[model samples]
Target: MARITKGILGGFSGKVGTIVGANWRGKDIIRSIPNPSNKPPSEKQMLQQMKFKLVVSFLRPLGSIQKKYFGLNSGSKSRINLAVSYTINEAVQIVADVPELIYNKILITKGDLTGFQDVAATPQAGNKIGLTWEDNTVQGNAAGTDRVTIVCYCRELGSFAVFEAAAERSALAAEVTLPTIYTGREMQVWAYLNTKEKNVACNSSYLGALTMI
Candidate 1:
């Protein structure tokens, strides 16, 4: 059995063998490990396991925030799993189809700094991801809001596409093509307004997922 240990989260955080995170209450914790019944998992089973593990590892750093957000009802990692699955759901290529989500007020920066005024994304025709956003330089202390950083996390491939919005355009709509392997799978997109002077980033906005058709 793997032993749990404390991490930098001011609480116990450890990973052993197939399990990750610390023991809490009577449970071992989230990033639930998979149990393969056979000696060697089938190709399809392997894919599913890979995806699950990827999601868990990716969300590892957000453990503390998730715990706080879930409070007393997290329930054996069910909340986190459901939340992740919901966010991972969505499809590919076409013009920006999502309703615009505007950031009108200053959101309390979560990680380090704040971000753009608004951001939205949806798949465009031809397996392309379309991103749109409004500049917030005038609304807040955006004296350093020089660029926009967008990231697309491929849930199937466990990879990312990091693209920078053109600095010259304030209300910019940018496009990025999905890899051939991504067809029929979903991706989570994230956005941030970045400045040249910070170590951390503007609180990242989860822009939803888009699956390639």
Candidate 2:
């Protein structure tokens, strides 16, 4: 790789001949494209690709939440990148040759903020999901005004519904209505708290799953 410094086409991007140029951080750089190989993928390589695809697809919908509350960016890696790496490595399981996400092991948000206590998720009337938790404000870095975020994932749909700032820690309760399409599906629930200023977040707690009414 070479930094593009002082040239007629300064800071160029995209492929030109055998080299590809793009901006990284703030610098323009170019690198030679590796020649395509005719060799078949190894079994290990295929397994790795499967794991990567599963993690990326699962986390893509939570991009906004991950960007705000996931681990801090390290060097060139963004928070989302960190989240993907963590999920792929620690939260995935290979069962009977199939890669699957361990719902409870997934972390929608990661930080040092105080988390919830005695949290529960239950089915409510009219396709609504009820969330309840004991108020633990002022415990560690928690506060009464801290915002709560709710995440619901329906495996049948391969999708996620996130409610940001659904309620405050003081409320101790909140309800979310699933889309009509999810009316009969089972959903895995998780919740986390963030400061009112959105500066920090708590590790999320999975509150178990329920069938949407």
Candidate 3:
């Protein structure tokens, strides 16, 4: 029998304390080591970068797992589970100083076929509506001939910001697309956000959400 590497599912035991401590301390320490000119990264910059990297790393395994374990019809349950751990941690770490980080929130406002009508004039097989930040994309069920909009409610800020391209055609689903360069039972989308801007918040929804048609 061919040896099957369990991959992440093999359940490798990771050192929690070591990983956390090293990630937390190493990030700050390295940035503060100072450059030839003796200028060091600000504490805020360190924290932002660390948080962004951590979230992207966490998503690394999730994307592959999704392609392997779940397909378009599997719904969002598995993806949600994979994302929660990293999402919560990123949320906590980013807002450690500012309570608003924890308090400010995002949620799915609209779901189902009824809401879809409002977004699309003649909803068909490919149209969808949902909240997306930078990369986050969520698609609704195409049960009815209506446009669906998934609204995300942000607590600190009144009302949610709907994605501009929520109803646009999918770049991935178009027919004349080139053949996939690589084939895998699994895949993941990794993102690295620039965190140098002061007072600019990292968009947590960049990966976007998607569901079965």
Error of 3 at 204 (Å): 14
Return whichever of 1 and 3 wins on lDDT: 1
Ranking by lDDT: 2, 1, 3
What are the per-residue Cα lDDT tens digits for candidate 1 across 1-213?
444355444334555566666656665465657776658778656555555554456555445434333223445555355434532332111224322112222121234344655678888767777777765556554644455666666655756666654442255666677777777778777766655554344555777777876
lDDT of 1 at 167: 45
Which candidate do you rate higher for TM-score, 1 or 3?
A: 1
Cα lDDT, model 1, residue 128:
78
Candidate 2 lDDT, 165-192, residue by residue in tens: 9999999999888789889889999999
TM-score of each: 0.46, 0.92, 0.21
Q: Please estimate how well model 3 matches the true structure, expressed as its whole-model Cα lDDT.
A: 0.28
Worst 10 residues of 3 by lDDT: 185-194
lDDT of each: 0.54, 0.90, 0.28
- Once fitted onto the true fold, the runs of candidate 3 whose alpha carbons sit more than 4 angstroms away are 1-38, 65-95, 98-141, 144-213
Put down candidate 3 lDDT per residue, 75-192, tens digits, no spaces: 3345444444435453444354532223223211111221221111111223322222221224433221122122222232232323322232222121111112211111111111
Q: In what order do the candidates fall by TM-score, top score first?
A: 2, 1, 3
> Superposing every Cα of model 1 onto the true structure, what RMSD results?
11.5
Using lDDT as the measure, which candidate wins?
Answer: 2
